[model samples]
Target: MADITTPDLPHSRHWRFSLDIEAIGWLILDRAETSTNTLSQEVLSELEQLMDPIESLAASEQMRGLVMLSDKDNGFAAGADISEFDDIAEPEVLRAALERTHRLFARLEQLSVPTAAGIHGFCLGGGLELALACHYRIAVDDDATRIGFPEVKLGIFPGFGGTGRSIRQAGPVDAMQMMLSGRNLRATQAKRIGIVDKLVRHRDTLRWAGRKAVLEKRRAKAAGLTERAAAMGPVRGYTARKMREETEKKVRPEHYPAPFALIDLFEKYGDDPLAMIGHESDAFIPLMNSDTAANLRRIFFLTEDLKKQRQRGSSFKRVHVVGAGVMGGDIAAWCALRGMAVTLQDLNMERIKPALDRARKLFQKRLKKRHLVDTAMLRLEPDPSGRGVARADVIIEAVLEDLEIKRNVFADVEEQAKPDAILATNTSSIELERIAEGLKDPGRLIGLHFFNPVAQLPLVEVVRSEHNSDEAVARGASFALAIAKSPVVVRSKPGFLVNRVLMPYMLGAVERVEKGESKELLDAAAVAFGMPMGPIELMDMVGLDVGKSVAQELGHDVPEGSQFNELVSAGKLGRKSGEGFYRWEDGKAVKGEVPEHADLQGLGRELVVPLVDATEAAVADGVVESPEKADIGVVLGTGFAPFRGGPLKARADGKV
Candidate 1:
């Protein structure tokens, strides 16, 4: 290999080209004016122009190999610029763009010298597709290094030659699974699955590893016998049928069509890479222009907008959760997982032990590594004597939903907590004003209401009353964001935002069940309308006792003779007690079949109308600041049909 240390070569706004000491041409991606690199039209066009210099280097025998990497520390690239998708209204226009990208990537793939992608952080969607185009992919071994084709999440599949190349590299089943599910693969997992050729210990060594892999002419992982067999016509059909069957179990074709379309693509063209590449846009173009795609993209932007509400330079580091029940324990554990020092205060260690146990399981599932799980466990301390109150930077009370109990907790917390420390309550339905009544400085108290099963739900209702200071409210919202939850600041009121909008919907379902509608049929109706679960199923998950309490607090009429109350009185509380409207087994509702002649569509409209009405009233009464905030809150907090955008959005679009 010749040693050519050139300072300059191809010039472009989004790419840097130079020859290193080892005669390797390093093409560094640094999208101008952005913290993260994305493959925008200008970026991709600049890359094509830069390819001229790359080919010249290879032709002159001055380059040993080509290594592509990013200058951005956050990621190699966050994928294609999604903002551009809004302008693409026609399939022909999108097809033309896809064809151009396919041509450019093909040029990179056919270059004389071996090419490698030095991947760090996230290489997702188009970024992953770009990596697949390279001869080799070398990733840094770290938690941040995530690689995947996440286009399916936006109601599309990989278009820039990913469908064919990924299957060629990782084999049909693994590649299809990665594309269909839109789940990211860690560096080690990527290496095992052949998406990555090698993994370096650190980002500093990524270039060296890429160079070594290129110079040594290391052969990429070849598909095994099983992989090859799976791609055969008969076998491919069987596998794709199985994939569709499994996918339909999670999402229906009417709601999410990308996964099914991708399965069909694989079944028809999995054997021939070239043919698959040529036909890729046939499936890709239509899905990109779909209503579901548009709504999902809207949701993606909404989520990003919410993240901007995070308070920078927050002084909160230590969290004290005063209760060891499900919500409190989970909240404390989540804080610990996010690198906060959390102290869980309860009456005794016995109560705290279950929380710790649950946290251990959550850690094992999320962190995956033993050392990381251990670190999280060490951050959570059990304080039976309430000693953490004096040292905590933020004190969150998650005790029982009794007004006096919460007031008493705050009275003690106000005295022991630091004067400037934030005082928050995780009250689901109670007004923050009532919770702050006994406090010496009520203005310092804010509501940080997290939904049940804190780990799964993303929304946190940051409730503020007339008594709360603006700084207190800002800090509460910041804390929610810091813990990786989307915070929607709502005025303190009974059933604030999500629960306020959700109560009537759940109660309406219960009322219909009492009037002779089948519980399973009603649930099916909700599912057909795109709700994640039926109201009955959700009530069961929330626990019937808890549901009845929130419903009453929200001023809904829950008649004493109602099935909901009757079931609660008989000790069948819900999933917690293993029985309600539906029997619970292993955390799943065992629902019976819906009747053949059930009016699912009519029932769906009837069930969803109350939710839409409540959302309108909540926005009108100023519970949330705007319709957009209410939409995000309902969608994330209660799983309110994301494809419809939200209740407010659905209403505006006349989709409800």
Candidate 2:
């Protein structure tokens, strides 16, 4: 594999052309301005210009075939630059931009010679659309290679020819599921779904292999008969209806218009690629201008900005988790998954095995890559004696939330670990300052709070105590990011940020239940307001006993004789006991009685107002530095409706 750059061919900062041995042109995409390539306007213009000469050559029978590859370390392209979307305020301008992009993609599709997209890393949204225009596509087979149209996440569907091309290539039903859910497919899955024509074993060899494959110009097999049957005519309508029903169960059509519009587009225009793409732009316009879109876009920027955040810390090469409970075990597992050496310390091997088992299951469920799982498992070392602290650069204590127990654990950890090793507590509710009180080198002690089901949730609250030095806090932040969790640096206080803001909401919700209001009604209200789960349902998942403990610790004013107290007294500790406000069966909540005619909108307000108030108070009290942190905390931590953009954004939009 070699790179050839010369003045004889056209070149741009984002794209360039090189001739392979077979005279096949490799249009390499490597945006000069950013680490990740995005289809910015400037990039689009350059691509358009490059195509002019390519088209002329194609007409003269000089070009053989084109293989598109990325010169970036990895990644074809993320998507179109979303920041540019904000500028297209008018429908006419948005339509014009969409048309221009479609024209460019169409030009690529009409290329006289065979075209193949060589994809690695992330080929998403516009990037996937670009790849679909190629006659064939070869993708690297790895966990890192993600291919999808995730524009729905930003409150818009793929405006480029993604919708039409995906339906035509893969079929309508599968296409709807991909676009509406915004779920990315791995290379193998992409191939199975008829999105990828060939799978490459290595990233470095993709260009050479793609050029060879395109030079052969083998006609890729069409979608299987079953797949085609599932996507067209009456069968397609049934599939679309089912998809819409499932979507409605989770998402309200009024709040989120993209998914419904996407469903409509595929259902109405699956056969006509031209009409399908035209409707895509029509459907995307209203959603892009909606307040929901703006708020979701803000979240997109926040998460993107978070990825670029770097901090100084001792190399977070090794981690020691002291305590083998759910939180501790999962944190240890997640660290190992990210390729960090982890030592999980518990009281005994009996306790340690469960944590390891939990981690092993999580790894198997996500990667399905045996070698990667084995590598992750190898990185995790179970120690019953807590001796691994000495070898760790970071020591996290995930013991019980009791102040005395935590203090004792911290003292033990501080004594056993190296002085420079960052000490962290995964205490969700306790004040970090109090936990670190009287400990030697308290500066090394910080809060590294991991949410439940650690492997799935992305937020990790990096709590900063008053004694925490910038370096210590930075190290904690760095470690959180290292584990693929978004870190929200917060001040030390009871309940910290996420739990602090959540206390009032939970207190109010349980209080309502105690007042004899229907459990179903309260939970329904939360779901109606866009919460991933109802407040009562969330409490049940967290364990009713745990919720009461947090409420007391945070001084939340739950009324006496509340359902929370009653449930604990009766030993109905939520999902564990299988009996709380709702009966549990097979890991699902079998809801009890629902009110016949309750003021649901008013109830939603009742559940939401307290969260908004608490978040505002937290921001004002300096517990959370800004509204952005508060937004991230609720969205990532508490499963706050991302479409609503956190409690504050909802309040600003008058939805709260």
Candidate 3:
């Protein structure tokens, strides 16, 4: 190895330039005042300034190659700074900014010296676009190394020449799917898909790999012949049509127009890379200004805000869940998956086996590596004897929702649990104070209410009662964060926040169903209104028996001889029982067609008004700390239409 030479360029704030004796110039991105690097306007401006020095070095013929990497430990860059998006109210301003980025990246791409991106951690969105501009992308093959264009998640597609370059490198179908879905690909997956040129197993070797690739003039993998053929006019049109159809099934064109716009762009210009690159801004600027984009960006920030609520000093490692039912089992599995040592207790191993089976499936899906999956699985133990209580940092009782059973379970837990261990209940509707009765130290008891399908939902209402110490509440919220859940601190009230706000909306749907409105029409209306699932389908998924129990606990008016009671009595429990308001097959609702001439007008508003009202009432009643917390709870906990922001936000915006 030869000695390195430092460049005496005008002082750059965000980028550092150095030239090795081998003449491999290194441009390290080290955005100041941030733990993670984002391509903010200031950072980009500094990058553009540094480009003059880069061009000077290349023009002098001293720079043999250029290697770009990040100085941040977490990732290369998290894409363009999303905070900057909020201030750009005009399309022309956004378009001008996009053009600046394009010109900068184009200069990098057209550099005479070979360029390589030494990627580690997350190389996402604009970061990925920057890498795509490079001659080669050498990625570190680690869990943190994810590569993708994720701008679609913000309701916009990439505008900095990514649309054309990604298609050229990975082919049209793969590129379109990547942009349309906004899904990140792991390092190995990126390499396999031709988005990445090389993968090194360790981060220390990333620069070495990039330096070698750049010095050797290593060519990136080109789109395969089949992929190239798919980009032809007729083939591209067929592919785009199929993509549009699939996208429509998941989201409507009116609700999410970015994906549709991308499809249109690709279909029109898939064969012409320069044309696609030139036209990307035309498509991107409009979507960036859409209401859906604004709302989705708000949601992105809301989630970021929720992340800040994680208690600073608190840490929870061992979790003990005392139930092998759906909620308990799934909760335990998720805890284990998030790197906690979890013990799931039940009556016997027979009851525990199913939970383990579900955990195995979840592990396989998430932790793709066999060793990783095995490691996660090993963290979860089946403790039918309830012995884990003594060692757990947090012991959650997810037994039957019955108050007496919960009380009895806690009384025993209090006897065996460690003195400082946080005690919690997974009860959706049961009041924490009532469940805290008979506990020796009631102040230690808090509510960590996880929603159903525990692995999927993000919100965990950390219910704080009058008796709970603030420290205990903070620790409870911390534990939720430890398991990768958003914690909404709520006053311990009936049905807490999410379920309480949700019950009225769900019950209203039931009343309408009983009033001769078609179940399919009711659900379709809500789906059109932006709810993930219809109220009727959601009810079936929640289980008729459990829904009735929560509704009754909340003191809702469930008249005798109602359809809800009739279904429960007839053993048509719901998706669990394979029957309810709708039939269930392979875990999906089987719905019949809506009757002709059935009034569907204002049905969505009619169903959601109660939910919005309940959210406002909860905020007013102090069930949650603020209207923002109420919105976060409802949006995250219930999957309230994210594009509407939340029920409260929708109501505030007068969308309701």
Q: CA shift at 385, candidate 3, in angstroms?
A: 1.0
Off by over 4 Å in 1: 1-10
lDDT of 3 by residue, 1-656 (tens): 45375647778789888888888898899999899999999988988888887888888888988999999999998899999997864887888898999999999998888999989999999999998999998888888888888888788999889999999998888888899899999988888778998888888987788778877888787798888787796998898899999999999888889999999999999988789999999999889889899988988888888787677878788999999998999999999999999999999999999999999999999998899999999999999999999999999999998899999999999999988898999989888889888887889889999988898889999999999888888888888888889999999999889999889999999998899888898898888788899999999999999999999999987787888899999999889999999889999999888655344436677789999999999989999888888887899988888888888888888889
Candidate 1 per-residue lDDT, tens place, 1-656, comes to 34454645556899878787778888889999999999999999999887877887888888878888999999998899999997764888888888999999999988888888999999999999898888999999998899999898889999899999888888888888899899999999888878898888899998788788788866577667777778896988899899999999989898889999999888899898788998999989889989889888988888888888777898679999999999999999999988999999999999999999999999999999999999999999999999999999989999999999999998989989998788999999999888888677889989889987889888898999998777888888888888889999999988998888888988888888999989898889899888989999989988888998998898887788888889999989889999998899999899787887556766787789999999999999999888888888889998887877888888788877
State each model's CA lDDT, in order: 0.88, 0.84, 0.89
Q: Rank the candidates by TM-score, best first.
A: 3, 1, 2
lDDT of 1 at 69: 90
- Comparing 1 and 2 on lDDT, the stronger one: 1
Model 2 worst lDDT window (10 residues):
1-10
Better of 2 and 3 by TM-score: 3
Q: Give the TM-score of candidate 1.
A: 0.97
Choose the strongest candidate by TM-score.
Answer: 3
Q: What is the C-alpha RMSD of each candidate to the true structure, in Å?
A: 1.7, 1.9, 1.5
